[model samples]
Target: MKQFREEWDLDSIYVVDSALYSSDNFQQLRQLRWITLVTASLKVVNILVESLGEETFEDIEVPGYRIASCCSDYGGVRQRWLVVESESGRAQ
Candidate 1:
């Protein structure tokens, strides 16, 4: 990210896999200005399911896909956890 900013003078948002997830890593990332889009691991999802219940999710329709999201916090930062649930992933 430092190199990207230095070389291209651009701020970046990362779209990463669940492999990058960890409590410490999330905290570190929260300290930076970079945005992240990542899927929550099943363990994390299960915790929310158990605590909040499935009905807490609200549907959001993006251009091509549907997302179910809820108010949540990650690494002390308030954010939403989203899940895709569209078959064709198209707004039809």
Candidate 2:
């Protein structure tokens, strides 16, 4: 959740302890919990953000303008990159 931490100033994501859920719908519920948590955190932090397929960004970040997507994906706080995706540019 580095993006949230750095850009949005959010702390770690909530622990969804899927194992604790013994219901048949545990998987679905766990996934939903993640979505709800991230969405709520964004709103609560007052970041001008949007949730597309994945990866939240500043409201002004475009689709292909070379984004430094330090998407600290939390489950919500796991980040997959120390840098961003770019062929010849820096992380946005």
Candidate 3:
């Protein structure tokens, strides 16, 4: 990320997967103005379930999908996270 910022002189948000969920990476990115859309890992999902329970999720309407979100902290930075479910995803 530092390299991307320094070399390209660009500051853009990235929608990332669980691979970028490390605290070190987030801490670095947070310093920049890079917004991250990280898919929640099982550990994060479990913590949210344990801390806030299911009551906190609010329904969100997206074009063709049923979505829901909850606000929580990730790597000490507060942000909203979304969860999408499908039978095939569960089978994995």
All candidates' TM-scores?
0.49, 0.18, 0.57
lDDT of 1 by residue, 11-44 (tens): 6565655565556566555634543455545466
Off by over 4 Å in 1: 1-9, 33-41, 49-65, 86-92
Q: lDDT of candidate 1 vs native?
A: 0.55
- Tell me the RMSD of model 1 versus the true structure: 5.6
Candidate with maximal TM-score? 3
In candidate 1 the C-alpha lDDT for residue 79 amounts to 64
How far is 6's C-alpha from truth in model 2 (Å)? Answer: 37
Q: How does model 2 score by TM-score? A: 0.18
Query: Distance from true position, residue 32, model 1, in Å?
Result: 3.8
Candidates 1 and 3, the one with greater TM-score: 3
Write candidate 2's Cα lDDT for 26-89 as tens digits.
4333323232222323342233223232353332355544332445433343433222223334
User: Model 2, residue 49: what's the lDDT?
Assistant: 29
Give the candidate order by descending TM-score.
Answer: 3, 1, 2
Pairs in steric clash, model 1? none
lDDT of each: 0.55, 0.35, 0.60
Candidate 2 C-alpha error for residue 46, in Å: 6.8
When 2 and 3 are scored with lDDT, the better candidate is: 3
Q: Model 2, residue 35: displacement in angstroms? A: 14
